[model samples]
Target: MQNQAEIQKLLVLCGTHSQTAFEQLYQQASPKLYGTAMRLLQNGELADEALQEAFVHIWHKASEYDPEKGSAFAWMATIVRYRALDIIRREKSQQNRSEAMANEQLALQQGEDFFIHELHVDEDQHLQLLQECLKALDSQQRKSVLLSYYYGYSHSEMVTRLKRPLGTIKSWIRRGMESVRECMQR
Candidate 1:
């Protein structure tokens, strides 16, 4: 089970879409992949989602695996890591959107008392602070951050929408978020 030869043989069988081999490979590899996902995501629910996506990808992409590029386990682990990262990013974006919407609705409907009661805010001071912080960011950063957090756009979506490199888009979102957090903390 822990042997490279066994893994490579299973991978070959998997390339032909052998159900038994897939099952066995899953049995042999799932625990390690699940552990990796859990470590990266830090939430069981998100980790589960990552693991599911990773397996779906593995099923489809098994034939594409190249031993020259890496070992079967390394290739699979890469898939799992990327999947987990994507899940975490999406979850964080969703959380940010939900919080922003709730804050807006709470401010409009119930005012600072609800913030104090529900969110433990001292006053209504923080309302619009996030918006202002967002406004302070550069255009690309602001757009990337808003698209990602407000609209739940993935990094790839942001890259496509913003017509930017993936690395640049990721940087914009990361830096923009840092700026927003810093501004809100003021």
Candidate 2:
């Protein structure tokens, strides 16, 4: 790893769009940042992604770095840490949703009929209503929502599976949900 002064100087040059300085900065600092990501994410693929994203952020926001606050390495590491944390949070939420779906399926198989008893609605009817609401969505919206909520796919996964941009995937899911909510409310 480069010394703090050298890293700081490289960061300043990167802010000026100096490609050589950026390359040097990346080569010098990426190992430590990758290690930081690996420690936080505990998965090689996720750590790689976090490191890549952190570098992208650092490249764009290099000028925003303030030497008065901390060392350049610390600022870069903070970006990686936050990215890894986001991935962790997203994975946990997906796992929770998957577990809930599994529990609901298990209850149904056991003839518990919790929805009928608790919500005072026939389970079949509830499911049918939801299906109809989902069908009312545009094809892309429906697909996006199903991939995200039913299959518990992260946005990044959806982007890869559906071949859509991240913002587009998010928009489709959001609008799809809003439409479903309106339909259900009626």
What C-alpha lDDT do the candidate models reach, one value each? 0.80, 0.86
Q: Give the alpha carbon lDDT tens digit for every residue of 14-34 in model 2.
A: 989888999999999999999
lDDT score, residue 31, model 1? 90
For residue 162, model 2's alpha carbon misses the true position, in angstroms, by: 9.7
What residue runs in model 2 are displaced by over 4 Å at the alpha carbon?
A: 108-186
- Identify the leading candidate in terms of TM-score: 2
- How high is each candidate's TM-score? 0.59, 0.66
